[model samples]
Structure formats: structure tokens, C-alpha cells
Target: MPQQNMGDFTLYFLAFDHGQNYQAMSPEERNKERFTREGVLELTHNHGTESDPSFAGYASGNSDPGRGFGHIAITVDNVEESCARFESLGVKFKKRPQDGRMRDIAFILDPDGYWIEIVPNKLKL
Candidate 1:
């Protein structure tokens, strides 16, 4: 996969495909039915070079929530600003920074319906 440097963070879109069943779902369907079917699995927070690094990854065929597969997190310089930019560009958000109990984090869906969590580079906690 190629790594894209998005100013504050780097993004790596993996080449792994979940298969035919997963590929059949539209982005909107993926958003509405997240984790309910097999789909693209993404991992973030790279601490080292691609050849020598530490990270976590997962993709599941089971729809059970207990499987523990969740969205990937990306650290950014400014959560609010980045979110506002995303909004202006018509990005769909699963959860905004001001919407839930966890106010500091935001979840935005990628074109493929995978949730990408946006977080502050520095945690308030």
C-alpha cells in the first residue's frame, strides 16, 4: 500500500480486500451496516517504518459485536478544524466531536464505509 502524508498524519490504504461479499456493498450500505459483513480492514498509528513497525489489524466475517473489530484512529493536529474542513467538503460523520459522551473524538466514514476515527494529536486526558 502507498502512504499518503496528510500534513498532520500519514494514511496507508491497505491492499487487502475482504472478498466478493465485502466488495458488493456500496459505501452507503457499508456505512449503515458497519461490521455486519466482511469488508476492508484498516489499521493506523504507525510507530516505525513500514518494514519494521508495530500495529494492529483485523477483518471479520462474523457480525457479532463481541468480535471487537472497530474503526481505525488517526491523530490530527486539530480535531475541530479538521472536522469543520471535512464538513465543508461534505464528509459524512458517524459521530462528531461535540455529539457524544466522548466529546474529543470524531468518527468519519471513508468512501468504502470504513469508520476512520479522528483524534487530537495531544489528548486532553
Candidate 2:
């Protein structure tokens, strides 16, 4: 897609060790296990024409785990339309486009089971 970025990345570590200890540890503990000076990095992308650029939301982390991290989101022009189009193409949705506690949103899972939140461009939190 013309608006898609091919160089975004999200990072995650295995918070569980088999079935022995399957609990989310504190940030400190998690970092100590494999912490870098930069624990987390959030990236912002601008969309729309240069005259009226809109926030496209955060990009994925530099890396992510199979079943650990939550998701990254993108603001679309229309949630319902986007969901319908993607669904027609066989995209798996973790959540359908509908009302949420804070806003209207939907979730689609990637092949790796990572959720990609889709929200309207005018959505408010």
C-alpha cells in the first residue's frame, strides 16, 4: 500500500518460560533479564497531504513476541469500510469495528497473532 511503511519494528521478550513461570514480571525484572539502555521506543508517523497531515498513530515496536506484546494501531479514514474490505480478503479479526469503552476500534491479527488496532481518523480517547 502507498501509505504502508516496510521498515517499522516492535520488540518483545518471552515473559513466560514454558509453563513453569507464566506470569508477567515487573518492568525492572523484565529489563534486568535483557534490558538495554533504550527499553522501549515509540514512533509516530504522519499521514495525509502535507498541507493537512494527520496522525497515523504509533508504528510497531522494533520487535515483538509471538504471544506477548499487545498491539500497534493505525488511524484509518473509516473503520467499518476498512474492516469490511480486509474481512473480504480473509483477514482474521480479533475484534470487529464497533463501539469501545473509549472509542470505536477494531483488532486484526497478523500471521504471528499480533493484533493491529484499527480506529477512525477522528477517534477520540
- Top of the candidates by lDDT: 1
Per-residue alpha-carbon lDDT of candidate 1 for residues 9-80, written as tens digits (9 for 90 to 100): 565545434353535677566445444543344445444544454533344312355566556777788899
- TM-score computed on alpha carbons, candidate 1: 0.48
Distance (Å) between predicted and true CA of 90, model 2?
A: 0.2
Best by TM-score: 1
Query: Considering only N, C-alpha and C atoms within 3 Å, which residue pairs clash in candidate 1?
Result: none
* Candidate 2 C-alpha lDDT tens digits along 5-124: 434433444222334332365545544544333223333243342345564433344255444456777778888899989989999987885645644789898765667888788844
The lDDT values for all models are 0.66, 0.58
- Candidate 2 CA-lDDT value: 0.58
The 10-residue segment of model 1 with minimum total lDDT is 54-63
